[model samples]
Target: MIRLSRCAWPGERGAAAGVRRPKAAYNRGMSRNGRIIVAMSGGVDSSVAACLLKEQGYECIGVFLRVGAAPAAATDESGTQSCEVPAAADAGAAPRPRLRHGCCSATDAIDARAVAGRLGIRFYALNFEADFERIIDYFVDEYAAARTPNPCVMCNVHLKFGKLLRYADAMDAEFIATGHYARIRRDAAGNATLARARNLAKDQSYVLFGVQRSALPRCVFPLGEFEDKRHVRALAAGLGLRVHDKPDSQEICFVPDNDYKELLRRRRPEALRAGDIRDTSGRVVGRHEGVANFTIGQRRSLGIALGRPVYVTSLNVVSNTVTIGERDDLLAGGLVAQRVNWLTDPPARGCDVATDIKIRHMHTPAAGRIRRRDDEAVEVRFDEPQSAVTPGQAAVFYQGEDCLGGGWIQEAR
Candidate 1:
């Protein structure tokens, strides 16, 4: 289980800042829409979510997760926050790098607190550094194993939904909400289903596939109905919230500079040893600094003089070799995924179901057939051959906009 620590801001009298021990008499029945815990990242989307939930008569509590990123103070006058990029170390001093991001910074925590204050809601900053470090380790390990890792998906699965839900239960909140662009639809029978947001461009349903089926009913996504980010920003601006125009966080929060290789070098230098790069004919075409530096579909930076383009077709960590081949060599008719989490009822072994498969977050959903291999695995065969069926990435199964389930890709065939 993930453990958390709470930090109290100065001048807050009792408990952690904005946190109050629930009274024995206090109950969910006291609130109009019960109590909700909002994961506020000091971003405009989450700010708007808190505002909307408050407007809907729900008692809201805003939470900022501090995952070891350096916090910069929010500007006093404008109440705006920006990530503090660490300066290079002075001569003879050991360089200490800080995680830089507009989100997950101290400035972001203050911005969230300011919004919560404006909305007349309680706010708390939770320390998730330990849990986040595990994520960083996962990011590094996957690369070391010669596979691409989707840390965002892992974060959503384990931290945002998993640990945050555990916190909500402790707080006696009825729901846990986030600014993710996804929807939870309830049928007449009150069964919840996850779906893509109306704004397909901003849809985050793929990463959210790991949410436990039983927990779907209590998961709330307030920004799902917004047609676009502009509408959400406009709402925040109209409400006088300061983060209305804050740029969306694009890079992975921990790797703020987007230099994963640099992180790997610091965390696991052994993974960066020079290796041989070979082609399909088993001939050494070139040499590479590391197998971790290449992914299955990468075409650039090969440092080879091949007259035609060649893509990374495979990586053998044991042999310490990267295999490059023509684009057609990357195509695969099917893939096997393990650790499947089915949002709906698990399909019986040997049953085949038609669905759309998404291999990556930005990849378009493709027509496919999924067959249950066991309770925890499935074989997905695409109607048409797909390129770059990368292992260690998610293969989310969908039926239209509804997210049925997903799993981690194990291999391609």
Candidate 2:
């Protein structure tokens, strides 16, 4: 198949918003040309994805991923309507509570169910607590080792695309769609590859780089072509979706209230022991509660008045030392990335391929040379010295709108 429309072409990946009316092919309710499972989050985007697919003549099944839970108080004392869904079945336990935040609570499932009812489709909730635990562990372990972690990347790799696709197979569904603002397109050789969304502000391709290339064929992005999020909401409202105005979940599901420190203290106290904050010269200037409280390029909360402004340049967990220096010290000429996964055929080792390496979800992709180090590693040498290249963050490689693949940032020097 070429493409549904030339408007869905690649060159305008970051183009401006456009008015959209659902094509007539989707507005008919009698056709079921293909079967799909939309990963509904109870948010407007996923809700609209299901609605659009249903309207577009696809038989859609709505699935809500129970990725995390809310507070105990957010539910009831009897465990009935509890915020957290237990890992296994409990006859005496109370059902999940209706959560207000819509991360993984009963509230999200309820919203999805309502949409499924309106669209006349089947709805199901699947448990993945064990998989979610590994993601939490990875987050804590990365901070314990003085590195930043991207939990979303791990979740996409192991849960959404990996496990969810397996569930789709059990239901005999051909595809598992998501509300992610990214696209999947094929190359001249008919290989499936990832691409940035038309809505540049909401592009989620960065966190999704870890998704397996083999699983690309089974994935669908219903919201990828919409440069304007408001258009999706408009479509939802026209379809009578109640969540058309629902607020997007802005905080991490596990670390709600944005307090990673408290979560770390409860789960990994060893990383929070008292430590020394040292100047670049190796002289101790002040003492801090723990290394977990600091991150690369942090310029405040050191509790020391060093006369001149200083930034955190590095953290050595083994030595329990925090190195502070001038702003220039935070810049890195390059970094080495490990555990690389290629969505396309990877260039040979020692072959320096031109790319734009995006270090963070929000950072601009920097022009760089990705020298294939080995089968599982690549060295990224930036055209200019990049700042605060923290370990544990994803280094997503891209060429124009096409996502080459990505890996974890293991070393910055």
Candidate 3:
């Protein structure tokens, strides 16, 4: 039922900017005859997303995104172990080439098809290989180069929330929906703001911090209000989606088998060269396989012996050095962030707006104040020094559950 060739579509996959929005038909709290396109990932969350939209009376279509640049032939054999879903049964099952993990492989597409069949909706698989290379491949490269890269944030900005929104426009759909555990609500001013999901443990608003301000109104996250995974699984099982019991994918989507270093070696071997592990005094305490293999505050992989435990303080990609220091040295009073996107208008200069700042996805939000700097970056001064303020990671801002927007951390002061 699918083409065997690599190239299919002649044009780019994402939606073109400046396209006019289609007329929306739904009234508040009522079903709309408007069409909705839900991104189905062959998992319970998204599978239930499609079902919920249809239940709400929206004309629904299910889409599976095909990503990664490796030839489908190569991935056919190798992809099953890492794929979140089972491989689609095709004639060439024996030659199942291992595909790099975390993308739409043969299995995810097939599982998505089954869900669509159950829902009685139109299903289509669109290839987004080139975009994935640009967004995810470069992400891994940066990390291997000793810089922390947030691929999920990049995917949300460029692929899922960005490109998918565009595709919905081309299909004349009123809105694009996903299974992410984040909520979108319009405030009293009619401003679309991202909010933490009801399920705090599974809240994914941090990764979605980079969603463009203009695209906020056209997006929907059905799983945001469902606080528990058990309820979602129960709903899925009740709805008869085969992915009801499928384990949630916890690895980076483009990474093969969740091995970041292995993916780096396959793509860019030069990045894996050994580098010096230095201390605060610049003394070479030891040698490391690569600076990229370490991250800020990482203590497990130093392979160096200090009288007391030491932590990774910094990774200087230019010098190819990993700096280790005492854990106390990792604390910082502030950080400088680039590519800042504010959901509301930019705050005034020197404005001490009290907010919560999250340096990484799992880190608890810290009280902080954001001040605009001239170089298109924001200076975030934490009320208390936070640990492991890693560069190249995102520092997302929030006002309670509302997403105020965020920026990429360039440095932690």
Candidate 4:
């Protein structure tokens, strides 16, 4: 076990290595008040987080999470059998796989440590590789099955909120912090609420919907207050952190190379079986490489060139057919989602309150009416028909910038 503990005193690099100290603000409450651990991914956002915590007079430590199997530096030279030459001399090496985007590796761990050293913070790289594989691997599998699985939501809920919180407690830390661009505030009722970040363009509350109510109190997001990325970069530069100018990771951390198909091919080759491309009436129009490679509203690289343009309307894993239709046929007036998480008490069914709902993170919110469905889903009737209301996508509901709550879209009609 990694013990998964936080660090006390940013400049005090050996606390985790067993150093005790005097009673400063960093050591307040001794056993009660613990250190703050910033999740540093060798990125600028998290680098600044540790800097801000130290400036606030709190004990802080920086940690990078390594989430994949360690890569072979050059190649695997192990031979299966021995020969007269002992196989060492004649054995050919296996070429290493190209490192993909997202998640920390051994290479990134070295960079994170350097950044921590520059910021005068204690640093360590924790191995969360198995947890990431368990969560993110399943996420890719679900998407291959035509379900929109939000790995970040699961990572925030289970790994960050669940496992990391546990790790904080084990280390006797008071709270865990991240570089997320969402604000956390207490409402009049004293309930912790998730709100949009000052930087509207970088707001991340959508993927954080899975955060448990109990975990909200122990979490802090420092970057949420800064409305501009420029300010964040400036803050890091002022602190002289090494990652001050490091490019922001815009893709899902695990799929950094933007090659999801390759990830699926490596993780779940069985799920990549060939499927059919079907019309709305179930008539086979063409053959598809696999349903995993397609998403609703996709048009290009479809490998089919009809005189008129066509778009993927739905995916059926059982039949292994990706159904296609014309643009107008993709519109849907309503949808339903499951596994709803509400920031407030669940909304009243049939309450025609004016609100904005975003079906996907990249999508702009549109006005909608929420009504109760027979099951654990709600009916969202968009003011104007929306396109490609695919199943398995999340539908996040918001009142202005406040995240009201949301659910997974189970159906669109």
Candidate 5:
């Protein structure tokens, strides 16, 4: 059974504190449109999303996913400050509270509850800690295998859209909405197509490539039509929402201290064994700590100096070695992706589908041609060689602003 914790407002003390309410309490006094569950993260973007949906006559139920452990103290109204220490911090110095900039913390949950109360909406904090741990395990496993993983993309695929959709169904809700800066446009035949938001700079279509195609019609993105974050904040401020100036979540929620290496050290120390750092010609230039400490295209803290700069070109888990080479070695003309997911119809095997490919979240979509290798795999040939085609990162495909599909990078060829 799915675990959940209901957040009650001040006026709902009686029912929320222990008084039982009827199951149909949520359905009574509904708005003109159907109910929509907003994934409120206690930020300006999600706050405005809830406000807009309410104004559009939809019964908005605000929900927050409690992903992390509760902090020692609650956060301020802005949800920007937190008291926490890094796992690798110096023990001699007085423990100072570091600025917590990640989402789904205790402070974030409180902020989300406050927003829901302000809007007079039914609020629920679902305990997703158990589900989130799986993502953390996936991160450790990927790094242990010498590959970089995108946990946010996987979170969207598995939790936000995956588990949350199930919750929506249980609640008898019509749609699940979020603050993601991506759009879904339906054609004349009611076929939903995912596209980039009006704000290209904040477009999050890359991370959303794994959303199940069938769920597109039921998904809603309120911030998709806005020009930028400024407008969203303004809307929140106008609505009297206290989180108008809240800072955007920066680091991974699970890695509050921004020290993934320390986390790996604790969780998978055996994977970080000492290994040989080899040059392109298989010559051991120096010794290193572990392959997990490095990623493709990284140049700093290499622990060896050959009087010339070198980048991590590849990692071998079987041999426990890190390969370094010139900058040119990081560029790749093609990549093979596994577990491919297509929002549109699957391209025929051996037929090249010309499209733009994004190797990483921040990467510019480069011109490329993707050909289906099998039912679950595809090969992408870049029009021009791209840099740092790291394995385990997503390779999202797009045609213009419409996101066609994507898959996890298996290897850069």
Candidate 6:
């Protein structure tokens, strides 16, 4: 299924349209008139991206990265698909209903291949199981250590752009393109820079700051200029692509139900071990089912009564206790971010700079003054106290619409 081309470039109006720019960065990851490997996920956005690139005269190769096998049959006490099953007991006698999560599933790969065929382009499913295993290990380990982890960032850094870039090099491709809602452009100095998408509502620049800056030039984002996701769906539909009507994938690909606590319990049982629920004063106010069940600033669902509402303020791994307190306790004045990855040039140590910080993906940006610390750290002092400055979550720095960089929250105080 493909639509009549829109001719993004002059003289290019169809999938088989002749290419005019031989050295365009969008097609220059290789020697000349370079080939592009579009990372298709069986979703409309990627499908549209591949469709547009092919029409624009690039030699497009559609590749769906195979990250995992089908999850085995299992159910929770409620007979719903649950991540609680232990790793060893997952393979059951009965088969489970297929999950339509919009990730790199086998079904998704097949759909990607079909799109490639419709476009008259080469297609392949690249095995990335080993890469996914490492990402999962890092995800579980971060939780086991009482820190919040952004698996998407790690996956982008290590695989989507890292291993995938290597694969492109081996294939003699000029660039790697994906459906990420971010923009890439060059600066006056001829260095590539990252920016938010034209559609601010769908901007995904936060999760992509870890990308190696050098590789940014070889990255192509075909949908960045579109102001609405509906436009993309319309374009794909106009082209007769089947995924044009597909719903957006909401849950984490690995955790289909978004019940991360269940995944943690299954993979890292220690995180679920019973632990004391203490007050800020070190009083044993209650007991909780391990630190994994709670996160900073979380209220409700916490089965405790102290004559007043209580919120999870902190997690002490050494003491094996979850500290609960009043809502005010969740307010943190500042934070320290570790393992910083600067998309732009980094400031000198102790150099003060003003930037907005986003603690979580959905959080509103908080105005803060940040200063470089060690080689891989930054200190964020917010203009005003911010609540629930969570650890393990990323602290992305932004200067207006530009994505400066970000790092993991090491401590929130």
RMSD (Å) of each candidate, 1 decimal: 10.6, 8.1, 9.9, 10.2, 10.4, 8.8
TM-score to native of every candidate shown: 0.84, 0.84, 0.84, 0.81, 0.85, 0.85
Report the backbone clash tally of model 1.
Answer: 1
The lDDT, on a scale of 0 to 1, for candidate 2 is 0.77
Worst ten-residue run, lDDT, model 6? Answer: 84-93
Q: 340-364 in candidate 1: lDDT tens per residue?
A: 8889877778989999999998898
The list of candidate 1 runs beyond 4 A from truth reads: 1-33, 69-102
Which runs of model 4 end up more than 4 angstroms from their true locations?
1-34, 70-100, 281-283, 349-353, 372-374
Ranking by lDDT: 5, 1, 2, 6, 3, 4
Error of 5 at 223 (Å): 0.7
| Native-to-model Cα distance after best TM-score fit, residue 377 in candidate 3, in Å | 1.0
Per-residue alpha-carbon lDDT of candidate 4 for residues 50-112, written as tens digits (9 for 90 to 100): 666666656776666667654322211121111110011100122123244464644446556
In model 5, how large is the Cα lDDT of residue 115? Answer: 69
- For model 2, residues 282-325, the per-residue Cα lDDT tens digits are 99999988888888888988889979999999998988988899
lDDT of 3: 0.75
Candidate scoring better on TM-score of 2 and 4: 2
> Over 4 Å off in model 6, which ranges?
1-31, 70-102, 305-309
lDDT of each: 0.78, 0.77, 0.75, 0.69, 0.79, 0.76
Global Cα lDDT for candidate 1: 0.78
Off by over 4 Å in 3: 1-33, 69-103
Better of 1 and 2 by lDDT: 1
Local error of candidate 6 at residue 107 (angstroms): 2.6
Q: Report the C-alpha lDDT of model 6 over 205-313, residue by residue, as the tens digit.
A: 8889889888888888888777878777766555556666777888778876778888888899877878899899999988888787778888888878878888989
Candidate 6 lDDT at 383 equals 95
Per-residue lDDT tens digits for candidate 3, residues 124-220, read 6666777788986677677876778888888888988777777776677768888898888876666677889888999999999899888887778
